[model samples]
Target: MKKFINRIFLLITFTAFAFNINAQIDLDTVKSQKFDTGKMWSFDYPPVEHFKEAYGLETNEEWFEDVRLSALRLPGCTASFVSADGLIMTNHHCARRVLEELSTKEKDLIADGFFAETLEDEIRIPNYYADQLVFIKDVTEEVQAAAETGETADEKAKNKEEKIKELTENLEKETGLRAQVVSLFNGAKFSLYGYKRYDDIRLVFAPEMQIAYFGGDFDNFTYPRYNLDFTLYRAYENGKPVQPEHFFKFTLNGIDPNEPIFTVGNPGSTQRLKTVAQLEYIRDVVYRGYAFVYDTYYNELEKLKTVAPERAEEFEDIRVNIGNAQKVITSIYKGLSDPYLMARKKDFQRKLQEAVWNNPELKEKYGTIWENIEKTQTELRQYGPKIMAYTINRRFTPQYFSIAQKLVDFANELQKPEEERLPDYKGDKLDSTIQSLYPEELDNLIENTKLAVWADFMRMQLGDDDNYIRSLFGNNKGKDAAEYLLKNSIIDDRDKVIELAKEGADAILNSGDPLIVFIKESQEQLKDLREKAEEISNTTEIYDDMLGQVIFKIYGTSIPPDANFTLRISDGKLASFDYNGTKAPLFTTFYGLYDRWYSFNKEYPWSLHEIWTHLPDDFDMSTPLNFISTNDIVGGNSGSAIINKNKEVVGLAFDGNMDSIVGNFIYMPHNNRCVAVDVRAIVHSIDKVYKAKRIADELKAGKIVD
Candidate 1:
């Protein structure tokens, strides 16, 4: 027995030699999370060497551009062309809001699936569009050169801003495309992106909301998911279906464990490159406070929802947003609090500082960047809460309050020259701003309930003793105050609000609307707070921009830049990992989904669509459903195309596992994963179950499945 025990000890000691990071406990530090820079590779400079070395794929510029053009950028998600006739595929959740808006009380399209049998049956989404990146140029030298002409920091900043604006305008005019100057690596590099936009986006097909959000909030951010979260839409040009030159061909049985895959999409944002100090400030102060603000609203909404359970369905949109926000902030907070992650961040900072500060020339120019940022962050702690609560933009997000704020700001901006006005009040954007100044059609009862909830929360944030607060609330600090504003403000009266908004500052100041009066009285203090906040913000930007230069000087393209809601190609593999003393499967099948419905006793989220239960004999229960990949993703990557090296669509990214929630800062591929709907799953359901023959036929015509 003693000999056997000794042998077991020796075997355990040598386990790392056998399993390495795959070992049960992974004795290696978090640094063992190789490829942690978050493969959010940008178009400007991809890690071509790493790709070649890791995947044995020798890719050229043509290949890069072709892959880049294949994906389309949505307002809050990403999608891709799947057919030559511009059939686009994305996450079903991405189209949830649009579906909700289209639903009639009689025919709830969101509850029941929407499958347009004919092309003419497709529904158009107004004011919605998708952009394809058709043009890109490196304008870093010109932008930085302009900044160098300034005698002072402020002047340098202004010079840079003006130059960027000029460059964007000239590019737009030259190419007749929408041009945007994107800052990469903080401001170390700048690239001009020109997109070809299609305004006429239409709904193609959607699964029932129940299947799309199976397990709902409980399963969100967790792995072992069985959700079929795919949607199809189409783009049109000149009232005709667009024929896209580049698109991903659907591939069946497209994945294998540890096989290389790539996710092409816009990843929204990531703070992976932030300094330890900056992250600490966010973790300790910023995120916690922001989380509270969002949760307060959620709690209040939940309470109101409880009061009128019949209207519970009305709050889903905001509730989903609030839940997501809360989860994100809290997860980031938790990740930062992790001693191991913090230690890794600290070590990384120490090593980078050592390299940066040791080079005499680099040190002299950029040594103080981090210190300046730290100081500014401290100052920010003072004014951030105040500005967040009281600023015109931050204070009012709901349409009614937002309209009142916009009207007041509009009147104020009208007093200035076009160049001097707030930028949003300056160009084509001004017209849209003006048009949105009037409230959208709203139900009085629904508006009152939500508005009262918001009003009560604001009062709590800004105590009654506050001059503006007292003026707005008087002594009534609850629903009464909210009701009073609703009654007194002509802002709710669309025609009246429009007339006053057009009459300019004179009309606004003399108007007797209590909401308007409250805003006017608050403007002076708000202005002072804003100026202080902007000063710190501007300074911080300059320093961070300099820091970017320093980091580039040190790391170059070896590390990817931060995500900024732009197209980035992330490379990884379809893989599984050991978890909870067991193994996680690479893919979940339709069998598991059915099992879930039965096990949960057909409850709401777990309830299968009635059609699903009576599936045809041709339906394949063993078909792949959801799967996990090591791909790096963030919020806006919702509908990114997961493709193989041959550019064949394999899966559609929708969510990430809970461990990936920390991917906002660190990517632990050892466990963290991007969850996707298998391409076969999407096609299987449409063909065998929903009988979406038109879509299935189109897909089959274009498929390159093995």
Candidate 2:
């Protein structure tokens, strides 16, 4: 009986092995999808025929121009002109920083929400501006000609930079607009974009943070969200609202199931075009290093919250920002670890290389590009850890260390000849550099904790026995070393720093301050590493440009260029998909918002504001709040206008489902979906919850309502 059982187990094992072999995919035969690069169609080369074929929607240049004119690019996100009177619409989270800046001790605008009953009541945001893309002119031929003039890669890069600067200056002078040379497809295409700038932007209405970030970090980057993440502002010029030639009319009738829609905005960046080796470096080194720092800082901040309860709110904000970064890095890391996705990337690269090598002309020019990039990646892997260790990231490193490093640099620059000094230390810029050496004072407790965290990170990266680490720590641990440095360092004192600076480079270099000595010791090695990294970068950049040119030759505009924070129009449809164990709904309603609030037992993140605790009798609970669509979007797509074929705004693109996070490298159309706040919900909340009928009326009328 025992012999029979053993034979049966062997047979079963052999069967399982056979099944695994049969199921394994042949990655070599994996063909790249047409839309894998995404639908971020450039206005310079809109996918007119593709749109017509896919959705039977015939779009012309006029339609494209109108859409482009309607969109507004914010400092870090996207917005749109919703009314002809320059009434702007964007995500509430996008306005958080401006709100904090505009707030006062007596009024917390971010927490309590804000409404300008009249035009005069609107508050101007300082140093904030919105840019409208007025026109685009292709400068690829001129730029490429200049780049080809130089024999060496570094010389070519310098020439390209000079030519771009010259073109930008000339265009700005001629057009009286903010002209920028936008590089697309690496350097294969260059477009000079002219922008009409609006520096005088004012807040109109904003919802409370409670509703803006409804589910907090839990629901962020997830669908079936019920966030009222919308805000309003007005663009002013010459102290009056500037009437635009084109804007999207707000529509109360929300989108239908499977209805075609377009997301018009700027997408920050994507790495879909990155080679497999480059992706590996980012996965193993760059992003992993960032993740370590963010995770460590986040944990430290969380601990500080308990120890320093009085500064809970301040620490919470820092943690929230760090948490968001951690999520993005973690998502990208997971995507890189996905074997199937990496395999797809490999297959795509293989096919492209095959295309290049199959043609003798292309092969001769680009044959060794991949090999060279791999070599650069190897060098980067070696330098990445050292850079991460020594770099003074203001977020983690204490102000004392940053000041020490800056003072050291300042002293060294002062010692150099006038012409040899860096631009920042020469001419009128010297005062600005001196001013930057002293920043505002930070709480001692927080600074000490942050210093300890940074020290721990350095030790983990470089090991405890590293020369710099051993010298700095001496006989102490990370926390004790941080305390010793803080107690002994005079660099944090402005008067002492100035006095040391006046005494010359020798005084500053040998200041006896622990932080100063630590930085001075590592400065030479850091400088050498940076120089080597820069040389490697220049070489890789030229090779990348060649690779991009070959890709453009093979695929043309069929595959869109990687996003570079420029305006783009992506097409998709309102749809639902399977998630977890069940199908996610196409739309979430205000009823679901209350459900979340109740389910979480009225906790802080899921808790409602006092104003929203009791809804008005006439308020509609079934109003569509947030919805998911098949639209392609990424980070900068936040606050983008989600419009129908008629160019009417039906939703505001705010976030994306977890699956869409991987869209940074590959567009998985089957599951990746754009999360948007329905326009109806925005109008509904403004009219009912906040009772800001004036803004709602303006949105509905496409003008400022009297």
Candidate 3:
């Protein structure tokens, strides 16, 4: 009777499996959305028709030019001219490093905040500059023609580089501005951008880090935020603030729910154009390994803070950065793990493949591209672990190993003739190279901790039986191995390293130092792997360009190119979304800020500064602090100015919600949102909390107010 029941169940399971296999869905039936690639519309190819259809706004070239002129690109973030007298607005986090540098023994600007009462009071920041896009010209045909002259992938890549250099230099000479050849859609299109750089940037106003980064790591990337993440700066020229023709006026009337909004800024890189095979490699190997590295370093740094109390602040900063990276990596890994999202990506890839294979010209030119990419990814998977293990990542590997590697390279380079030496070791670059090779200070404890973490990662990835792992750690591992290596390695001492380097290549190579020996033994293998990877990359890039061409041919400018940190305009609406089984509001208020503070017992990250602890009677608790918009954004979109159709500043783009992390590969407008500091909150904070009436009055007047 038992055997009979088992037979019946096996029969039923087999029948169900057969039926499911027979009913599999066809690739042809899978549909792709228009905005699946996102609305990161390039300035070179603005989505005029789409804008008209979506917002009923007839935007022209003049309007785009004005919008472009108003925007500014910082070192790694974005900003905009908010007032006529060069009053620039950006996120507080973006200016944190500058604030630290500006602080003196008498004052801690980062802790107490800063406000320049008069024009002369603004502090000039050295080696800091902001770039305004002054001119743009399409140079696609010229670049493609140059690339076509090459007969091989390597030759094509070289020719393309040379052509871009030539075009950039020419543009710089013509416009008398910093010029760059911006590649769009993976080299399908190229545009020359000339930037009018403002070198004399000064800090005008900044909020305390406590408020700027309120809620801290726990609340980063989460929506319904109440943080006042904003700062003001002034761009000076010839000892005075220049009156810019184009700038966004700070609107007193705040944003409304579902209102059309635009974000114009330099969004960094995105991988929406990458092949499915490449994305799979990133999902399974690249990001996974990176996530592990970030997690390990972050945890180790946290532990280090307890032991190294004097450097607690420094360690905390590093930990915060690592925590942020870990979050992004894990989020991307999660997104890639989603079956539905992966299916959508597959459907989009299939659509592209069908479009190509349907045409004889495209099929002959790009048929093997996907298959070749898959083959490359397979090869990369084999080498990926080894590369990850040996790579001299600053965050993971000890500085002594890096210094040793540099010393070895220096000795080798010195052996070569002047003409045969690499650029870094020749002429004007030699002094800088030597100076960098011998640093003034070395943090022994931090470096050893990093080494221990790295040893553990290597053991995990490469296994205990692996040759290098076995040699480095016979029976011991982790902390023991790290200590042994540091104890035996003479490179840890700057004087010893300099002397060894001075003795020439033979002495450095035969040093028998544990770190040096390991580097030397793995040098040949690392070099070979790097060469092979570069070759594969060159081939992949050539095919990528071809794929880009086909994509452009099929969709034209309707599908905006993948972001490359060049200025772009993305359109969306101020909106709310569902999260954690509850609806997030379109805007959050100061009342919610206090709620979080009190809810957490006013402890740490959520704690308010002294000034913010007791608010004035006039300070409106109902004032909106932060808001959400469906606008597409990424890492580099921080400090982007969110603007309305009238070109008024509505908010400052500082972050993206958790859902937006997947924006790296695809944009889902339904849930993904840009988190921004409300412009009204900035005005109110300046007027009531900081009591900077001069800056507040200028922001209101859109000019310098006495």
State, as a TM-score between 0 and 1, how close model 3 is to the true structure: 0.88
- List runs of model 1 lying over 4 Å from the truth: 1-34, 104-106, 296-318, 392-523, 577-582, 703-706
| Pairs that clash in candidate 3 | none
Candidate 2 per-residue lDDT, tens place, 65-125, comes to: 9999999999899999999999999999899999999999998998999999999999999
Query: Candidate 1 or 3, higher lDDT?
Result: 3
lDDT for each residue of candidate 1 in 180-289, tens digit (9 for 90 to 100): 99999988999999999989999989999889999887678877999989889999998888998898888885687756899999999888878877888777566755
- Candidate 3 stretches with Cα past 4 Å from truth are 1-31, 303-315, 382-384, 403-445, 459-465, 474-514
lDDT of 3 by residue, 1-706 (tens): 9999999999999999987875685645656687889999998888899999888989999999999999999999999999999999999998999999999999899899999989999999989999999888999999989888888888988998899999999888877899999878877888999999999999999999999999988898898788899999999999999899999999979876656899989898899988889899988777877776778778888888789788887988787777778889889988988766777788888988999899998899888878988988888877777887888886677787788788877878988999999898888887677777877888888888887878877776687888788666555677898876666678677878777776777888777776777787777698888888787788888778887888888889888899888899999998789998699998899989999999999988788889998788899999989999999999888899999999999999999999999999989999999999998999999999899999999999999887
Q: How close is each model in CA RMSD to the real structure?
A: 7.7, 5.6, 6.4
Model 3: lDDT of residue 666: 89
Candidate 1 lowest-lDDT run of ten: 25-34
Candidate 3, run of 10 with poorest lDDT: 22-31
- lDDT, candidates in the order shown: 0.81, 0.87, 0.87
Model 2 stretches with alpha carbons more than 4 Å out: 1-31, 306-312, 403-445, 459-465, 473-515
